[model samples]
Target: MMNSLKHITCAFALAALLALPQFAPAAEAADQPQRPILSVDGRGTANTEPDMATVAVGITTYATDAGKAQNDNAWVAGEIQKAIAQLGIADKDIQTRNYSFRPTYRQDKGHENEINGYTVDNTVIVTVRDVKLTGKVIDAALSHGANEISSLDFSASNTQGVRKEALRSAVNDARDKANVIASALGKKIVGVQNVSESTGYLETRRFAGNMMLAMAKDVETPVAPGSLSLSANVHIDFILSD
Candidate 1:
């Protein structure tokens, strides 16, 4: 009877040990492997004519009297606002960028001296929704006492759509590159494990410095917003299988 009781106890202990395995932690029991991953970089580009432009127009008024300078600046700013409205630009699209009153300095002999004048600068940024009207808007601003054309930038009105398309193209390019590399190594692509993307636009414009702004007086300010290129670069890690 003692021998039979010991045998039954041993059998129950063995069964309990076997049942414990069913409750084991998944993270501890999962099969994991570390291996070299294939990384490929791909780039994609898409170009479209810019649909919108941002123009900075301002009046720089200088006079010996501070009150006169302030009054003149206000007058010119009003004219610019009126001109912008006449072109169908809504009030919301026109924004005041800068308003300042500062003393002017001039060269007196070999030293810099403070001139007897106060300069008032009033600037506004306007978004021109139509690309074809860029030149006309510039001309109108200049005629309306806008002495300083600070900057002109071209951009797309619907940037999100362009960015999405560029990203899709970049993904396709990365997959193609991975396929080529895998094909050369006699391995097939199993799956894409990870992907990252970097995207933006490059702006190249005609505005440079004070001299360029001065040169606008002689020319018709021929602005050629040829084509804006939106680009995307992607890095992908793809798992391969034999």
Candidate 2:
């Protein structure tokens, strides 16, 4: 009888242990305190004068003979290249972009497309380091048989430096605004909890160099690079203490 009573007691203890509830993640999260966080976004922009200019210049020619068309294009392209070399621009700055010969088409009164002649085009992309002489380069090319101008883009030579400056400015801006908000709410910043950045750059737009000459200028084509802007944005989370 004594042995049976001890066995029963042991069984009862084991059953009590199995009936106890498990402590889970749901219960742990309820015990945690909510942290006071201040969130803000800040933006900064920096503008500077561009120092480099890139222009696409080319010559297009048409002739009944395919060989003649290519020859004419090469001759005119050669003259333009010589003029560019005389301007003290480095040989590496001139890069041949496109050279092609295709059949020219004409639509007759019957609405049928007819091949009238062959057209040849030769183009070069030039990177001019001196922004001030952008107008002179355009003038030189036009005077020497560069008839098709596709695009002109201006930008700074040292873009990395400008980008860093913009990011630093963004961080400073975030700190300043956070300080203002915290002071207004009767709180102080205990420390920085998180930081994130959103960076952006406005791609430089292309300008038509040929159209600029239509402005009736007796001198070299006048070009104004204006200014380029480098921008950055940052989001900061600061822990608040009151």
Candidate 3:
């Protein structure tokens, strides 16, 4: 009787263990139903006129003596600054961008290691708050001992409003695309799952080469303040529902 009772208890335990459910494999679990998502990209652009300009002017001088080279460069730079200031530009707007004093080497076969002369370079960045003064500033700097015009760039003073407008347009474009896709799939967009964005603006750049600087002293420089294009891009992941 004792052996029979023990056998019955073991059989009951084995049956209970077999009744428990088995776990599915990872691949099988992945095949289960999931929420549908739609991803799309949208772009928008806004145009606005540039309101300000920046000019980079430099003076370079070479001499056998380092002190003379530095002195000549400083004098020329000071004259250029004075000319810019006379155009109603405040002292704060004129900033020194770069200054370098280095020795030049003779590239001849017999004197490759000999120091030929010393060179000094001084560059200043001038901000013209008024767009109309862009040409005047360039001409003034060139006429007043500025030998090198590195770069000139035009930009808007305030880009906040235009950027916001572009962002709104980008969002609208994304929504329109999402709606079209969802309608084609016999589903409706229920909500937005994720969103990401990037924004940028293009500047109107003008480069003044050596020839342009040489001729600028004879004629008034001409500057065209072209419009700037600000762009926004957005990626949206939308949830779809039947």
Highest-TM-score candidate = 2
Over 4 Å off, model 2: 1-34, 110-113, 209-218
Each prediction's whole-model lDDT (CA) = 0.81, 0.83, 0.87
Candidate 2 structure quality by residue, lDDT tens digits, 9-75: 9999998887664545668888988668999888888777889999888788989988899898888
Model 3, 52-77: lDDT tens digits are 89899978899999899999998998
In candidate 2, list every pair of residues with a backbone clash: none
Ranking by lDDT: 3, 2, 1
- How many steric clashes does model 1 contain? 0
Which candidate number has the best lDDT?
Answer: 3
Candidate 2, 91: how far from true, in Å?
A: 1.5
Q: Rank the candidate models, highest TM-score first.
A: 2, 1, 3
Clashing pairs in 3: none
Alpha-carbon RMSD to native, per candidate: 4.3, 5.5, 6.5
Clashes of each: 0, 0, 0
